[model samples]
Target: MVATQQTAGLSTSGRAVQAVALLLGFYLLAAAIVLGLLGLDLALYLGSDHLRPALFKIWALTAVVIYPVLRVVFLTRRPKGGESGGLLVGRAEQPALWARVDRLAERTGVRGPAEIRLTAEVNAAVREDTRLLGLIPGKRHLEIGVPLLIGLTEAELDAVLAHEFGHYSNQDVRLAGITVAGRTAIVHTIGTLHERADRQQAEDAAELRAEAEDRLARGKQPKDRSAGDGGVQRVLARLFTRYARLYFRVSESVGRRQEYAADRAAAEIAGRDATASALRKIPTLVAAQNFYLGAYATLGWDAGLLPAPGQVYGGFAKLLADPGRRAELAAMGLALPEREADPYDSHPPIAQRVAAIEALPADGRGTEGAGPALDVLHEPERTLAELEAVTLVPEAATKRRVDWPELVAESHLAHAREAAQPILRALTGSGLPGTVDALLDAVDRGEGRQLAERLPRSAAATAATGRAAREFLRPALRAGTARLVVLALAESGLARWELSWSAAPALVLPEGMAETFDAALDAVVADTPDTAPLRSLLVAAGLAPVAG
Candidate 1:
């Protein structure tokens, strides 16, 4: 990407300073809003008489407005830096990864994380348990994603790690906790206030409904009245919500600048080209891993089957190795991803980040040649298995595990069987035996159109009737019949699903049968149906009596 001046006029270090100031300002303003409301209410209560209803009402309303804020301030929850999610990898378990972390920490001029954890996300992160609003820095923790370890080159991995460590070097990690804590508390308080308002509104509606019912029963006209409920809570929520938005904008603006500083540090630690390359590949790698998981790894999830441990996590490597899939991913990697402009976007666009690195001179302490980042772990397979165990959902972990080949066959067979079920049900509803042979008999007897009409069709298929309906139903019928054929062939040991690493599972048949499999099924379900080729196929496979 060509470097631009408009978006990045300030130096990285200068932006870091400005972000620190904004963060401080955000906190100060938050404190002022809460204190200002409370102070005003206190003055009115202490200085003014309590006997006046209007004056007392004014004070009470002010108190209600400040109530949520007061709770946020005094009853704030302390930040536990590393609590939820991620499996903690002890130094003893993976000395190689820890050694690299320690080396990078020294280079970045910051102490390494006290604990390292592995997570299922696509990015790396650092967090500090800063005490007393970042004044006292406590335990530091680092989280590295499994995908990053498996997908990136060693230097690319280092660049990512360096960027996270940059937050520590820039002194932003300590204070980021406070900014995050403030946002969490503000958002929580607003949500609590809204819940209270909703409950009160529901109660008021129920009370009105009861009154109307009573009036209707007594032969009297129902009267209209205002609910006039939850007004205080609503007002309080609105006030806090505005403050929360401001806090988000200011803090996140700081967050964006901090990201640039971190990226700069990454570039200095790793080469400019390496840093830029890592930035480009991370998004694409994330996309590929997600696609692999949804399309391949969980194919048999409905049938309680999973890729054996390590395979679930390591299957992504197979995708990148495929020439066709690699080209697609490379194209995806070249373009920086775009999305709806959000105020809380904490990182600069990848294009801009890469361009910034491009502008820098080649002056980095980059290490040796490229290798898989997974090399950093001792016994990578064992570590990956452990990662899979921790990352997979509890139910997924309990699923029956199988090798990739068997997993593909079993999963696809399960899907085929499931798809055929609807057709069976449709046949039974029409006073038929609902067997494959019964379906063949009905089609042969010219009941195909009637049966097609009875089968479930999409709204688009709604317009089609008579001959048109049969045409629309052609694909569904053929698919159902194909499933039946595959089931029979498998039962008789004539066909099987062969694993294809680059594509979907292949339904392979015997030498002569493989070539005619599709043509046979098509001939069997054509508009003017012919079951001879299909019946011949069954006979050859030794499953006799195609139509019973």
Candidate 2:
């Protein structure tokens, strides 16, 4: 029995490692493909017969020269150098921080002192080598950016450090540091390229718009209008737009995955809840820091818009004072807080991260915390069996059917009309009597589906709307199917839509229909022979199946 148990444990550990390795492999493969494509595009563009090789060479050379010059200008124009050494563990003058770090190191059984570092941003990282002059193995270093240390409470700070030490103790810190360095380098390269492309795009757009306007002014038919003297401008605009989109999309994807990996590592080191709390806190600190920096820059005190020293610390203090603001911010995103620059985002949305973490079992065991973190983590086969036993029923037939009038009344189409009322009233008040009313009435009663059918059907519109419905609306509706059924009946003339488990004639009652909609959906789908496929479809749509 002991030997069997040991073998089972080894097998589970091996699987966990395989899972993480697979994910990392996929990421590297994607990065390589993207880089390859980019290289190919550059070669083709530069070598094209239509474009002179010498001219292309000169342009590339000029771009290379301009990039660093702009980078230096941007960096130099920002605030000058601040404190560069490790930020003292606690308060600037407090000795308790170091004491606490010593205690944590002793508890974790990791060698080396924690080398702290201060930065405006809220972050803590474990560096393997602290001595700037030489490489040192087994000499681990910890840097807690001042902002993060100041933001977290003593316990929270300890939790953060423990999490870092978890990496060190597990011998994962070196690997993580290497990954970070590689990602940073890639992101920086992409960022530089994106910036240059954006600048070029702005210039190209202005030139194209001017040329198009000029052609229009000359009374040339729209189709007859040439690109004018800005052929190069038009090409550059197209190229830049394509590059900008590709760069951001790829960067955001990679960034989100890296964040997940890091979060998982942190959770393994610290308790899940503690890690969650730290993730929640950093956003508010960052926001506060940003606000202060903006204010400082506006007042001409700071050199640029970046956060000032101690700004995050001040922000944390404000949150401590205003509990309401703190709660609001905490609730903003459970995993990853939203930021203004989402295009260049290097992390997943907070809500997604929270969901992922919540999915983990309570315990911190398992390789990279990928398996059930709960005590007695279930075998994969057992887990599958359990899931199969908890069969779900579709909502459509289980609940009462909605009538056409009620559906129309409760739909977003009606909401849009209601929203447009004020604008129409304002237009009428401004002396456009009777003009806005006709438009408003026409819009309010417009049947999107009917209009779609009547219009000269474009294959493109059909494909696009189908894709949108499948990709976006279907999932959204499934997510809130129960609430949607209730809401639909409540807001409509319908009255009877309740969920039911048994087979029954689902009626579209004028009242109380909301209570029956779930039952109606289940009955409709359950009667079908291919219940398994039907249930899968409903699940994909985001609906919960009936208990029966």
Candidate 3:
């Protein structure tokens, strides 16, 4: 494998030094070529007599490209951006976690992290603060995601951490800053110049269109030839794109090899079986984590509500640990991964990584069976919640906090209240008051079909007319009617939304109303007029009786 060959020939420090020299020299080389063009332009100016005026135009054109290339060489995150936003903690607060990391770093043959931080992502990474195009390493940082702590066991966590530490041990992190910054500069430069070229082209086209319009009005034929501003910058963008592709092809090819080397190191440190299991289970954990955040954690997020303090991120562990969820996640993890190999992808497919890890000859390292990874932290719930508050969402600080139950119920009600808006609009649009009573009144008056036809329904229903249209709209009408009735009931204390982990928010009806409620909704929107029974139910709930 290319990975094996790369690591075998060069020492870790040698690879790092070579990468730094290669990328930094590549940037300098580009700068020199640009200077060469200007130098030749000066030579033509000083030595030639006939091409003197044309050189002025050449200078003007070359000046446009020189600044962007030089700017990329100098600016463009020379220090490779500041430390990412996260909850930074030290050994004093989490000594047990620190000890584990220090030992791993020692065994992995690298200096231990200068800082450990927690983030909200479902991933972990190690980065360095480097100087002079990543030639000298400064402070190092390791960021661990809380979900990994919550979902993985100690052995799997060890494999994941070791994989990231392997990047350092192989010196992958050292030149990573320089290579990433270079590629970033090229991409930004291309995007910036192309944007200006597009705008200029648009403005020139607009001017030409206006001239043509004026000529047409004056009873003259429009000119066929275009006399517009040339896209010199567009041509420059294409050149940069060609060069940038070469940089990516070189750096990312090395990056993919580094991933293989890291996976091998992780397998050696934490056992091949544990490493492979972690690789497969990670995707499932990420899926479950995203689902938990969307479905359960942020149920009341948009309504300016969040779970009670220390419960937001901590609650995900409870969901993952639930007896019902464990079986489902286990089943999900067994499914085979289907991913196409992309040449530009920095990491190989999970299947490939697992196969490579398993191919190694038997090593004595084995899973520790050390229980949950969360045991690494002292009071993990507090740590998770603290990270959630600072880094999870920007608007979290201003949101009102409530227990999970109230948050779930209130959020559904808030959604229900919002969904009611369109139904009310449909009612008011059809010349009826936006109320369930008015809808029922129209049905009793034998014009329910006409009213249903007018309001916008589903695509299948909208395509029909006459009796078929009414039939198509029947289910939707019943559902919409139930929403209006439920909102009224919820407001009047006859209905409420209950939290359901396995399903959507279940609307709980009052006692003695559960069995006939669905049929009553159907009857109200049926072909035949049947208001007596349905209206009777609402009247008993203290709604006024229909007047003659």
Winner by lDDT between candidate 3 and candidate 2: 3
Candidate 3 residue pairs that clash? none
lDDT of 2 by residue, 1-548 (tens): 99987875564345334433443543454355445555665777767777766766766755554444344322323332233443333334334555666777777777745355433356676666422111124455566555554456554565567766765555444443333433443344445545555666676677777877887899864343333433333343344345445544554554455566556755665557666666666677677556543432122212112112222133334433456655655665344644443665655666666567667778643223222111111232332222222321232123332332333223433443444444334434433332322322222344212222322334644456654533332222222223333333334434333221121113343433335445543432221212233234334434444331
* Model 2 error, position 38 (Å): 19
Per-model C-alpha lDDT, please? Answer: 0.78, 0.45, 0.79
- Write model 1 residue lDDT over 1-548, tens digit each, in one string: 23544344334335445445655654565578677877876777688665568767876776666665556544656454448477788889989999999999999999889999888788899988887666577889899988888888899998999999999977777657667766666677677778888888888988988998999999988888757557677766787778777777767777777888999999888778778888989989888888899878888899899988887887777777788888887788787766543567767678878788889987654454388898998887777788887778889867998988889888877876787777777788888875667777888898876676666789978787777777798887787777777776765667778877677778886667777878987876787898778777677766667444
How high is the lDDT of residue 39 in model 3? 92
Please say which candidate is ahead in TM-score: 2 or 3: 3
Q: State candidate 2's TM-score.
A: 0.37
Residue pairs with backbone atoms closer than 3 Å in model 1 (clashes): none
Q: Which candidate wins on lDDT?
A: 3
Question: Could you give the candidate ranking by lDDT, starting with the highest?
Answer: 3, 1, 2
Candidate 3, residues 395-494: lDDT per residue as tens digits?
7889998987798778878887887776677778877787778878877888676665665677877887777876887776677778888777777767
